[model samples]
Target chain A: MVAVYRISAIAVMVEVAIQSMSVVFGIAGQGKWIQEGGVLDKAVIEAREFVFPEVIGYLIHGLNGTILIPLTALILLVSSFFTKVPGAVKWASLVLLAVAVQITLGMSASGLPVLGALHGLNALLLLGAAFYAARLVRRSRTADQGDRLASRA
Target chain B: MGMGYAEHGGHGGQVAGGRSVTSLVADPRRPADVSVTLAAGKERFRLPSGRAFDGFTLNGGSPGPVIRATLGQLVEVRLVNGSVPDGITLHWHGVDVPNAADGVAGVTQDAVRIGEEHVYRFIADQAGTFWYHSHQMSHEQVRGGLLGALVVTPPEQPAETVDVVALVHLYDGVRTVNGNEGDVRVTVPPGKRARVRIVNTDNGPMSAWVGGASYRLVAVDGTDLNRPDPVRDTGVLVTAGGRADVEVTMPEDGSPVRVHLGGTTAVVLGSKSYDAPVVRPPATTLDLLSYGMRASLGFDPNRPDRRFDYDIGRRPGFLRGRPGLWWTVNGSIFPDVPMFVVNEGDVVRMRISNHSGDVHPMHLHGHHAVVLSRNGIPAAGSPWWVDSLNVADGESYEIAFVADNPGIWMDHCHNLPHAAEGLVAHLMYEGVTTPFMIGGTEGNEPE
Candidate 1:
């Protein structure tokens, strides 16, 4: 269970980074397309016209942020309940909270646009929280190994 | 082999032994009867209630001006592009105009670019509730308020029936009826019938119901229903890009009746200022398939000269090089989608099946089709004629129309977003070809 919790937390951390990079690449590609006189109107976006290859970055970002990262974070939360690591549940809860806030900001970014900055910042917060949860498992495992060795000696 | 625009042979250059799309016309030599020039521009305007919006407008206003014409009039509209950066074209929704006047950018004609003008001359053949909106970058342009109501009255006017147009649009996420955030009041004397033409220009189906009285759905997509029974406690679901004309007789008590539009805004009909009760939208929706008495469809759908399967599904794939869960037509993406070919006068039958987990209002430009069956169940009501038909998830609709109009026409999703998402196909006459190219120097992105 500790290993499952550790792996799920680490996956969330990795996925958050991927989501950030993919969305930024997507926006950069879109900006370049407009610079080349490719009108990036709602029609073009909805039609999902591939003005640039990096537009796939948006799909990757969206799918990972909405479905993959949140799903992995949820698994970490459930695994935290099964693990006996100290403060594992607290760190898992913080990661889940940051993910929830990040998704809310992302969904409203198109409408408000200003929320996009907060969305990016929340991704970093989520990454840090997930990393802390993953480290908790490692520290607990190391402590168990130390006790086992000491008692055997 | 790539499934991209490179595979499409419909753009630019004329096809051998085919009629040019520009050659299809409605009596070019005939003198104009009703001439109206609309200048399209990008404007920052505000509604009467002080709600501001920045978008493309016709004649400097969103929802433009109401264009009213008598039936059979030669409606000549000169569309001038003022300042819209991406250009614009007015597609007369639900008006089965001549193929040349269909106003589909890249299909029938090129986008009316800045400092350029295009003339659309068509006989107002069918009289009902219709509208015109920019077909270029339509998902953005239309949503940005580049549309208006077009009402065509029959030559012989009906007695004392007041006509009202309720064009529902969402601006910056604010739902408004005829560009008004709240109720738009119309004066209809007591016991007089008022025809409220509700146009759903949004991307989803909208439910409209009368609060103060039972109303009759007199028309659907500008086609009159045969013996439409009065409906109460039921709302009519107007598909995106479709219209419904509901006739309500004001009560003798002089109380205003609220025609609820999409449960948000409304058009109040009364003799004077009186706020009617805000009735909640009915739980039941009037099913057009069985709403009115049966009538002749004018043409037989049983014997089809051409049959096509428009199977709408979704799959993870690259559309125009962008990878996403894109909508497909007959298991193929845009530019690779089927080009339904038919000879003029061919009776065409189409089975539109949607498994895309979303509702798509399928619109066929320049033609009106009669719904024959849905999910294998035959339509038991009046011949439901529609230019825009809503096909929901898991639902299959069988529709048939005569290939009387000869030109290249767009058969695409009217939910402009879905249409942009690659749910677009083309219906072409055997010997007709378009000269316009999408996404080239013309920048014609007609969604």
Candidate 2:
């Protein structure tokens, strides 16, 4: 259970980082191709291909935060009761709270671009917190038992 | 000066020099109204201010000599390429030359090589302001001074006291008026009328105004304005690859009227001299949409047979291994952007919207269009005809035109750099095709 939680937490961090970079390209040029051309629409479409990929990026980021991160936090919470990992429960709660805040910011950014701008900035914060929490475990004898239980399940 | 219809049949196109040069031999018996010879080569010339720069010239001068003719006159031009390293072809901007004479580097003909010559024979059926420039790597060649003014006059000569062609270009960071880095003197007697034909050849629009007098806008992009009103303290913004003809009456006191071309270059008429005025745009611009007298259009622009919406935006993408912010049109990019398909005689309307936070001057080859509306407001003045239209960020323009010319024509941004950076597309007439491409082994980079 503990090993599965760490893997999901690492996946969440990687997704958040990719989302941050994709969002920047999605808004960089903003408007530069509306110039004169009879067949310009196709050229403009190709120029902005990075923008289309943004939706898929956001979906993955959403799934990582809403589904995977929560499942990781739940497993960590139940495992801490049996294990002697000090501050493990506190770290899991903070990770869950950070993921919730990150998702809210991501959802808010579509209607309010100013908030969208904030979403990118906040993603780095979420990634850093998740990275720290993912490695928070001491990897002692108790975590080994949790891992064995996780592998059996 | 009007030309009588002479049968131009069997003009031989001779192939020489193995896939590089295709020369057109004009029939000696075909009685052309005007014969002109141009030499395209490298030259080092000093501006009026004595600032020197190496540039590509059509006839050893920064702006190739003016080729003047009358409407309906057959103009024959022979282009001799004298070693420019790369190749070149003369594109008659604003003149609807026949497909063979259109001068696209690859589409119509190959680029003229070193020491090789090409002949361009076309009839100047329309009269107003137009220009000729090298279409082969035009973005660089034109800026390097490979362009010149081409004036086709009315059948009858005008009685104006003076006529001046002010082609605005930037050479080596210096603003130039007809190849002069500073004031160009145009002598016109007091009380006599003078006409100034201004061509904006830069990658952006230029503002021209009579700094100390009133002037009437006569024409734009080779189309005459109907009952143009004279206004002082105002200016006209000539888009990239666009032209504007303004007429000014000389002051009776012999005080020269300074026509400022974008703050740096100016035309000083008569004796009195004025410093180039700071080109501060007026709080309100000259609304070309409602400036001149409204005229009846032959067809209803409101009822277009085909309508296309082209919206420009930007995003990050990898173009040819270079990752950067690239432009988009209608949610797509180059090669995928709409290749507007049309047929001969189709009345097509395109609504262009720009949200890219920058200005783009749109240019269409083979035909000119009339502005129908801007931002949903119908044009209420003279039929605003344009081959190049300036579209600013956050603005939407509705333009319509009849597809009278049938061929595969390039339609792209007049801002050559933008066009090179994927803001380019083509207008394909049904049943017409091209054997040329952008990056072919036969050495063709049309932009």
How does each model score on lDDT?
A: 0.85, 0.73
Candidate 2 local accuracy as lDDT?
0.73
TM-score, cand. 1: 0.79
Question: How would you encode candidate 2's per-residue C-alpha lDDT over B303-344 as one tens digit per residue?
Answer: 766777667877667655666567887766564576676666
Task: Categorize the docking of model 2.
Answer: incorrect
> For all the predictions, what are the DockQ values?
0.06, 0.04
lDDT of 2 by residue, A1-153 (tens): 556556655766776666665455433323331221111221122222233333444455556555665565566556645445666666666766767677677655644579867766777776776677568653544577798999999
Query: Which residue runs does candidate 1 get wrong by more than 4 Å?
Result: A1-64, A67-153, B1-16
Candidate 2 wrong stretches, greater than 4 Å: A1-153, B1-30, B271-281
- TM-score of each candidate structure, all chains considered together: 0.79, 0.71
